[model samples]
Target: MALQILLQLIVTGLAWGSVYALIALGFVLIFKATDIFNFAQPELMMLGAYLSFTLITALKLPFLPAFLVTLVLMTVISSLLEMMVIRPLVGEPVLAVIMVTLGLANVIRGMTGLIWGYEELQFPKPFSAQPIMLFGAAINQAEIFTILATALLLVVFFIFFKYSRAGLSMRATAEDTSTAFLMGINVKRVFTASWAIASVVATIAGVLLATFTYLEPIMGHAGLKALPALILGGMDSVVGAILGGLIIGVAENLAGFYLEQYLGGGINEITAYVIVLIVMMVRPYGLFGTKEIERV
Candidate 1:
């Protein structure tokens, strides 16, 4: 019985970890391209899920078409956000940009509540409502699909970043914005594209999360939880984000299972933060982040 419970917890942790990875990826992608830590990413993701839910449940649209439409709309919304809020902050201090994003997150959360109401809404599952059994443990089809889909999306993004022309432009911009501009790269356009891509990624993550949990105005706050993954994986590494998420997920599950008996309630929520604190104390740059040198 003990072994079976442990196995089940591991599987559940992995599935939830994948969702965290997807959300963390959005934060890493936008930060990599623009050097701005977007606190609004979680809210953006929540908005995406809500929008998708509205399309499927309220408008009575089919899943396939609704998914595509939601992606496109998220892309547009992200781009517009970049233009209106982020673009003007070019060359501004990092603190200023971060503060702006914090405000943006609050604005998004309030706006979503105002528009959609504070009620918890149910989201339709993209897959059939069946549980898949593996090695004496069972997980819902939606959980399995969400994990697989997030992995596939990460692969696609990896390929795009490595092989595509636009991907090269994005990298170049990240390397040195002024130098990229000198080489005729449209820095503004790249920033817009980064934000758009981040939004789309967040939207997908949100949809997946809504599959397992209730959807509400507060759903976006989950993005804040992803900060631990970002810190663990390094802010600039997308691959690190995925790995960090998995580590955090597994660790949380294990703690909940093993330590809950001693620690009582809510240990799961604090597990990631505790891990981050330890990691920072040991290695501030994270697992994959480049070491920084400071000069007096």
Candidate 2:
């Protein structure tokens, strides 16, 4: 019985962790390309969810159509954001760029509230709620879908980053912006692509999460929770992001299951941060993060 409960928690954790991983990937991708830590990422995730909800509920579009449309719209929106807001800040101090992102986050959050309202809204479920037994643990179809969708998306990302011409250009640019431009790589296009891709990834995560529960502006907080995963995996490593998310997810669930009873509520909420703190004390740069040295 104990083992069954543990398995159940692990499976559920992986599902939520996948969402965190996707969110973390968005953060890492843009940071790698532009060295800009986008504070608006969570709000972008929130915006995706709200836009998806509006498409389905207001426009009466089916789930598949709504999902694709949301992706297209977010890609354009993200590109515009990069061009209009971030492009002007080029060559500015990193602190200035970061502050702009913080301001952008508030603007996105406020706009979402004004448009979607603060009330929780029901999201159409893409999968049935019926629980199926997996290795003696019951798992919901929605959880299964979340995990599978994450896997598929990761595969697609791998292919894109590994084989696509644009992907190679982005990689080259990320490694050295000046050299990339000297080599004739279009750095400006790569920046737009990175933002668009990050937004699309965030949207997918947002829509998947909405399938599991009521959609509310507060759901963007999940992006904040993903910070530990981002830090734990190393901010620049994609594989680390995925692994860190899974670890945090499973650890939080296990902690909540076992420790919450003794500690009296909310242990799960703090578990990810606590674990990251301990890990960083030892690794400093994260388990898989690259170490950088600068000469005076």
Candidate 3:
């Protein structure tokens, strides 16, 4: 109830929210471009974390170098999947695409287990260990960096999708793939670009998350946590993803903190779903989702 405690909680929420937003953004980007709910995204995130960890720990690479390498590698992998597997499946049944992505997720997860082994590993502490104080609340340097990095990425994405040619093509394709193709937008290329962008964001999210939680092949389940955010924000709205993520993140922190005293513990695990249920009751199409209309 103290003002400082509330501030500290909010800072924590923002950090976690940034992570969720990045993860959810990946989902929204892919779905917007391809209408494919990439169930493999979580696994891709896990792969990002593992690859970065390996580069830094095993190869003795510097943090910046390793992070950059991981980003490029993951982008290539995601782009390849889109070009090889997803591109070929275009115009197929929606369920089939969903199932294939889910299968690919499992395949990635299994591969990660074989390579990384089934253990929780720590990412190297590359950020400063010192905690910065703001308004009588202490925040870790890593947390500060995470917030800044997330914000910077969001801004860059806003500019990209707003001003860049590729971003415009993505928007056009999302609006109407056939129309975009007719206009010479290269819809297939848009799909591949979206996946590459999603992979980059997921890798960034994964690296940040590894700083907070122990990294394991199963850690990719973090995507499940972001799904409700994706729904709450509007599956097709990128900005909605950002808003939804913050709301869910803050709600989880506040509810977990206060409710733990009453629920015995771990209520945060279901907070996103609870929020989703409540939000859907009020706005079935989600806060920013487009509603369909039909004339009979």
lDDT (CA) for every model shown? 0.88, 0.91, 0.89
* Model 1 score (lDDT): 0.88
TM-score of every prediction relative to native: 0.96, 0.97, 0.97
Candidate 1 per-residue lDDT, tens place, 1-296, comes to 67777877887788778878888988998898898999999999999999999999988999878888999999999899999998899889999999999999999999999998999987887777777777767767777777788889988988998999999999999889989999999988999999999999999989888988879999876776688988999888888899998888888989988998999978988999999999999989998777889999
**Structure candidate 1, residue pairs in collision:** none
Better of 1 and 2 by TM-score: 2
Score candidate 2 by lDDT. 0.91
* lDDT by residue for model 2 (1-296), tens: 88989888998899889989989999999999999999888888888988988899899999989999999999999999999999999999999999999999899988888888889999987777789898888888888898899999999999999999988899999889999999899899999999999999999999988888778887889887789999999989999988888888889999999998899899999999999999999988887889777789
Q: Which parts of model 1 have CA positions greater than 4 angstroms off?
A: none
Mark the 10 consecutive residues where model 2 has the least summed lDDT: 125-134
> lDDT score, residue 111, model 1?
93
- Worst-scoring 10-residue span by lDDT in model 3: 1-10
Clash total of candidate 1: 0
